[model samples]
Target: MPATRRPIRQLPDELISQIAAGEVVERPASVVRELVDNALDAGATQVTVRLQSGGVRLISVEDDGQGILREELPIAFRRHATSKIGNLHDLESVATMGFRGEALAAINSIADCAILSRANGFAEAFLLDGRTGELRPVARSVGTTVEVKELFYSTPARRKFLKTDATELAHCIEAVRRHALARPDVSFAIWHEGKLVEQWRRCTDLDPVIALDQRLGDVLGQEFLTQSMRVQTIASDNNLRPRIWGRVGIPDAARTRADQQFAYVNGRFVRDKVLAHAARSAYEDVLHGHRQPVYALYLAMDPARVDVNVHPTKIEVRFRDSREVHQGVRHAVEDALAKPRSAGLEVAAQLDSAPLNNGFSVEVRQPQSVPMYSAQPGIGLVSKPEYRFGMQPDMPGHKVSDVGAIWQRETAPVADPIPQEEWPLGRAVAQLQGIYILAENTQGLVVVDMHAAHERIVYERLKNQLNSITGAGAHPRTIVSQPLLIPVTFAATPDEVATAEVHSETLVTLGLVISPFSPRTLAVRAVPNSLVQGDAVSLARSVLAELGQHDASTVIERAQNELLSTMACHGAVRANRRLTLEEMNGLLRQMEETERSDQCNHGRPTWRQISIKELDALFLRGR
Candidate 1:
């Protein structure tokens, strides 16, 4: 053994700091979370967070709590320094939310950090500079105030990932709010870009929720909160007993993404796909596909069973018993969503209680002539069948009518009243209950629903051309269109104009080009090829309707889809009649070749998966 010595096994300081920073700081919100947690841990009854440009430029947190001693000031900036936990044994069961003893160290490495502190009886304040870990005595201060300046200055790459100032500030406020809710005894305040964004009076009761609703008025706007539901549930197991408490908004209440589904594991906000997905699945039966619900679920479990120490920033947790947690979460969310609307504030299903003959309108005594465009007379979930375009298992299957002589029984209807333009596809043999048309064809039997057929046609056109056109414009989307001589005008608000820009190109592709003729007047011209000249204004208005009704990121595509869907609805044959063979067969052939024939333009499926063999087995004629 010739002096076996490992030659300088060491990692770079920069690399070490980067790795440490990974655990301590993830985003701007993470920075606020750690500071807030530390303030609460210090026995602070009230804390205020001020941000400059979404915490990217500056983040300052002040707390009126028992401050640190002069001698301990330098150690607070060093790594592995904390008064929250004492030993390695504490790691096994972390009682406090922030006890990794790494947040300050990691944050200081990337952002310029400063901490000013003073004890209860101490007359003077002590300052700790993270850049140098130098402690200097200052004249006068009575509490701790931490200011994080030039956040991520050492890591420009990380700063690049931050969202708009407005969005980042929103995230910062949201994080603070969630904790404020968890610790109702503590008060929280927030300021962004010098403007006071939100403030909360110290209250332990559930009333803070209403105040939060006010702060997030734009996101949890009245429209979304209007459909909210309250939830509470419990779970018990061999080694752990957990309770989940919070309110869950309906699927329609979600803003844009699943980001609205907030969950706190032991008072720490976490970002988890599994937990969010489980919460989403619980509401699938009631909401549309891919549409998430707004929820605030707090999981209080044995500290030992749930580990929040895997990362420094702690936006995720490792559940010792995920199944128990999942079950509890799913049950709570489902139960909340299932509950009927609260008394006196119910969302009416329909304006009229009864149905009228001819299926044209309701309220026969008034003698109205309006047609029932939706399944329900007015806008309601029950009337908007999610599976009307196809078979989604979310809704019932549709029957095809009329076919070739061999399938002639299905197509018995389209004998009259259809426009001359669509008559050439095939003779409508039958109109099945006014919703479907059975047409006979030489190649195969075709079954068509007038509504679904139109949707398929429009969806294919949009799907094929959308991606290519969205990025070709000067402003993220190119209008491949020409403006009209006299711009069609519509009254709208500033928010609507902003939403319109996101979908502006999609509007052009759908054959309309709009611009703000005035702050409130939007000028529209041209229309989709499928839309008649006179129908342009109402169709445009309807597109706006669908846009407002939906929480879509791609407002333009959503608006366009709405227009096409509306066209499909109007073009779809009225329900309750008979159809012929030729018309139904044509529909079947068209659906087979159409892209996404499985789902109509608005997310409804168009076909069922029942195999021909299954049809034979039903009759006891199996081979």
Candidate 2:
């Protein structure tokens, strides 16, 4: 069937605005985000958001910022009219959050909107109504107040898609929370049904880092400050490159979901894939399985290098060079988490203080004469040791046995005591069941999981050895490939086959050789030397999926880490192997020097500090 051609014409003003509204406004939260963007762009130092019925019935955003001129108040509601940018050059390097000018027009189209404002230098104030296009004199301070009533009233279909009032209110609060996190210099408050829901006060600290930390503590909670490490990385003499600064939660603080991950570019929040992928990759060596890391990373770079106008909502950005961003974020997070938390004064100070340790002294105790186990090659658990080594035999019936001497502390002169500050993990005092190493520090008891701690130390050492073998270069983590005795084939999707063929060189670096055996089948004839026993088909699938989404180095490093982790778990010192005082202390020294020694490769905590206050409470001594 043939249809007659119609002439193309410009759409009506109301229809055009409504069409733009569909993209700018998803729900009440969308309106809240856009309005807050405008308030912050106006140089607002304090912003108060009042909502009714989850902002569907009423939304009033009052900001103490430079208000609009009375003459320009009416034009502010017109589509494509904005004071943010002048032309294409301004659009190219947009520094403001709301420049598209589509938010006001789009929001006004579906809701009854009003703006009451008094310009900075003007004494008079005026109120402009969007529906009637009426302006009248009003009394107000030197600021702006924008009220949106009956959202989606004109478009009832959009209203039906919204969730319950409670869910919508939660989303609206989250939108404001994002803004508050980025700006510690500004105070924010949210009110629902005339009751205050949330508030974040402005920080007055002179140091930006301290102010940001205080803000994080207030918003994310004090536990975040205690469990996270500060991250600050600047590019070397490159002004255009990104300068990242924020905090990343320790491996032990990893959550089940990714809700706490927040990334901002030039003070504007964004959900960039490159930033998310880079942050996740940095935690691959420490966090295990489906655990998601928590971080609040703020990236500051030249505004010209990023295109924020790509999305209508301005929540997503397109970086001119995404590789630079990925590398910067990944390295920043990795460096911040490289050092163990136990070695830092920040963590030590966070421990509860008590007077219970006032009379505590370092004691060097002798080991009990218990049957000790010998190292069994390739064994990961306790082995039988029925006989003692280097035992002098008794001649016939003449026995010279003094078993008590072996368990007695030597009566030698004590050496000078070493300062506790020098040994953060402190001196090893005892070993509990050959499984835990208990030490004493200034803060109090330090309990270490011997097997888990040794596993992490061994894993780091293995990684360092691999890095040395590969050397520092573009392909620094190149894996050694091992040919398989028999090829493993699997039915592969076309996308997977395409990814395998296209990234053949990259796959080779990861020690994988996947090739097409048939139109619908792929064969993996080789794998990484360390992972030769692993399932080749599954390895190939994982590598292909990683290559499809991330760069070659990400996949290479991840695959190498998995192999090293398994090897480390197998090679670490086994449980139930009693250690001398010297051996235990040496292990503690190694742990203090090792990277990420606080947690094992499986994201389990390797060490814990039971503070003096905690001990006092446990024994009821504080009372």
Candidate 3:
């Protein structure tokens, strides 16, 4: 007869696992940690981690640690079954990083976990069932290999929350790197999907900064790493002993994300925004809006002054001397960015893939296009933004017009190219898709998205209106306000309803009239002529998206931004569209006159650059 099974009287198994999984599994990174912890506990001197497609489908961690004893194999998944610590008081002053004993329980609860571990004296391997926490005898390698398949299997909601494969993989890679760096004495080999990714031999000397070179070298390429800026500062006081030291590649040593700006406290990886704020504070004059300087920073402080158990991920940290820490970061960033490697430091730029008006790509590099103003001597963050693209819309997330090249014929619609002496940025190379403009800047090439660029242009116009001392300036643009034959109505959230009301008049100011039709409904009676010609629906949708994220900005600011973004989208160049040199120059000149021209409406930098030295190295000239 089969043994009587105890009924799960209370909760459903799925619900139970989901709750347990929260602590055990978050993303692919979480799985990597639990697996590595198991390996380390097994006394593994060498660990190998493998991931594929961001760990969506696979995550394998192998280690040569003291493998699990045959009988204790099943106990690994039982909650609180940790070898790190035993009993209650040990939890308070936990010596090991992970001793909750929940890592395996939590992981197995969410994912299809398979574990095979064998002790040194064991004659055969152990097959452990993660689901039931059951152990049995089997034959396998002496070391341990933990495989996690179908993560978040019991929690469907969490599966949707996972980021793209690339993003998730990046996070996993970062986590693995942290572990590898932390345990330098442990030989680490990382492979993914049948291919060897990284083979790092064991290090007799483990310094946190060692991985800094390896990490940056992978992201920025070793060529740039060869010539990095090193800056250091020392300030010792009873109240504060702040020391700053790091290497920052010239402005060109940049990445798509600010991943390189690592912050560490006491040899532990931490994410401190205040430190980031300080880092940004250091790059105040050097970097433009869309760019961030790169560095690997290590901060030291008394253990009592800092706290690490603040977040589940442990990325964020609290400092005892917040001010001193901030000051230290600022010193390091400024000093490193200011030094001599400035010669080879070129900015990472987006390829000008948009079609050009000249019938061929305008291959030219411009000089530091982050404008050198006659009105103001040099660049400063607090100071007004300098014109990089000639002219820019006043705000963020708007389209820029591509007026790269214009025709001199009588049939031409706009003016001719303004001379470069007057405003060199005003010159155009080509206009693409009716929106993006390929223009030449002094330091490097500038590619302007007409819609994003124009959004900035119009945003500035509205801002000037707000700041203008001229006439009450409420004068309507006097152009016709196109009416939709059928008014468009939308269901908005409570905040969006308030957002519509606050910006109702502002919308009217921009030639769009929005009114509350119901508690959750907003009626769009009229729209800007530009929007009406295209898709007014998309323009109206912007209000809902803008309000959902944050409401700190006033309705006027939000509405106005939405309006400008819409206008830029409608008026700026489109893909495969064409324009003349005159149009391009006009666009560039406008960007020059405007402020905050580096990035488009969405905070993406409109133009980027790779220095001549970088180009030469690409061709092996500087090698």
Candidate 4:
């Protein structure tokens, strides 16, 4: 049977416009985004949004910016009419937020929309009905106000998809939050059901740095500013002109959901995959599994290098050179987070400076004397006379047994009376249950998981040694490979086999030898000497899986790190193991010098600083 041929006919202009609206206006939030983009593009300094019934009933956006001329009011709602870009050159280097010109036309199609505007030179404003094409003289300020009423009223099917008013209103608020964050100089206000919801005032300072921080505090709350690390970087390479700057929350402040991460490019909020992945990778060693990092990163680059027109809503962007952008963002975030923090000193200072009625001071008394353990030679404390491996006779008791004699020969004793500010972790005062180390610093207290801290220190040292042995730019020193006495064969997918073949050089560098034994099978010849105790077949498969998923440059190192981490965990001091003051202090000093020492290999915080203000609050001091 032959199918009936359908006639090709042009759709009506109204229907075409409505079809376009489906892509741009998904919900109340979508309308808010489009309208706000328009306002921002118009050079609005102050924007006000008023919503009713989650914008399903009405949405009013007023902006103090350059308004459309009276004659252009009618054309503004027509399809393909935009003032943002006039030619191909403007399209390539788009700086304005609303360039597509489809927003107004699409939004008007789904809802009853009206625009009231008075141009800069006009004496009076004019109003136009989007649906009826009716224009009339109206009195208004020298700005623009767009009113959208009865959203999806003409299409009951679409209205049925609307959620409860509260849920929709939350989404609308979130949309506004993104805009407010990107533009710290602009003031934003939101009203829902005639009640004020949120308002962010313009920053008073003209300095970009101070203004950004002030605005961040205003929008994200002061706690975020206190808990986050400031990130600012200008690309060092002459070829790349991208500048990335913003704030990333400390690892302890990680959230369960990714809702707090906000990224902007060229002052336009976007959810780009490259940017998200870059940020995530930077926190790879710090954040625990299933925990999402929170950050507000801004990237400034030549607009010609990015395409914001890829998405109808303008929330997604396409970078012309994704790798360059990814590296730039990753390096910027990594550099900021890698710097040693003064624990939570900034936060503690803020709390301490806060106004209080009572004028009482909290004091932290120092330990009168170091608790002396019974002189048990070679047990918990190693006295100077007992130090055998080139130990200085005048040295204090060193906890040699905990880390073995290797540390004794390598590290020198730390001088006494260390400055409080010089070493934030401070000197160890006592051990708790043989599992935790309690230290006193400028801050009230620092509690450390001894095993966790030691594990990280050992892991970092191992990696550094490996890097030194490999040397710079030379092929990594071949990890000694042990030939398997009995060859092992395993079934592999074609993709896995292809990955093994493609990354053969990378595998060799990691001391793995894999070959295709047959069409569907792979045979392992040798494995790294360090991982000989592990399942060679499984390790080979895991390495191949990693290679297929991530860049080859990092896959081998990551695989090696996992093995090193396991080794470190076993070598680190165990729980219920007593230590002398000297041993605990030595460990603390090592931690201060180690990179990423704040977290263990498994992304768990190794130590925490409790400030005096926090302790005072707990005791209800100066309430």
Q: Best by lDDT, which number?
A: 2
Task: Return the TM-score for each candidate structure.
Answer: 0.51, 0.74, 0.47, 0.76
TM-score of 4: 0.76
Predicted candidate 4 versus true structure: per-residue lDDT over 100-156, tens digit per residue: 777888889989999999877679899999989999999999789999999998899
Q: Give a tens-digit lDDT track for model 3, residues 133-241.
A: 6677767777888888888877889999999987887777777776654455567777777677676666544553554555445544565455456555664666355
lDDT of 4: 0.74
Worst 10 residues of 3 by lDDT: 377-386
Leading candidate by TM-score? 4
Compose the digit string of candidate 2's lDDT tens values, residues 1-623. Answer: 00221221233444334321338899899999999988888888899999999999999999988888888888888877777765567677888887766788889999999999987779999999999999999999878999999999988888999999999999999999999999998899999999999999999888999999989988999878888889998555868679999999988778999999999999999999999999999987788789999999999989999988767788889999999889989999998888887665457356432234555442435467522322222121111222221222222222212111111111221123234455788767788765788887778788888889977876776566567554346445555666765677899999898888888877666566889999889988776543442346666776677677755545555566765665566545556656655456556766776798888988788887877777767668969
Residue 81 error, candidate 1, Å: 1.4
Candidate with the larger lDDT of 1 and 4:
4
* CA-lDDT, candidates in order: 0.57, 0.76, 0.57, 0.74
In candidate 4, stretches whose alpha carbon ends up further than 4 angstroms from where it belongs are 1-22, 236-241, 342-367, 371-418, 468-558, 617-623
Ranking by TM-score: 4, 2, 1, 3
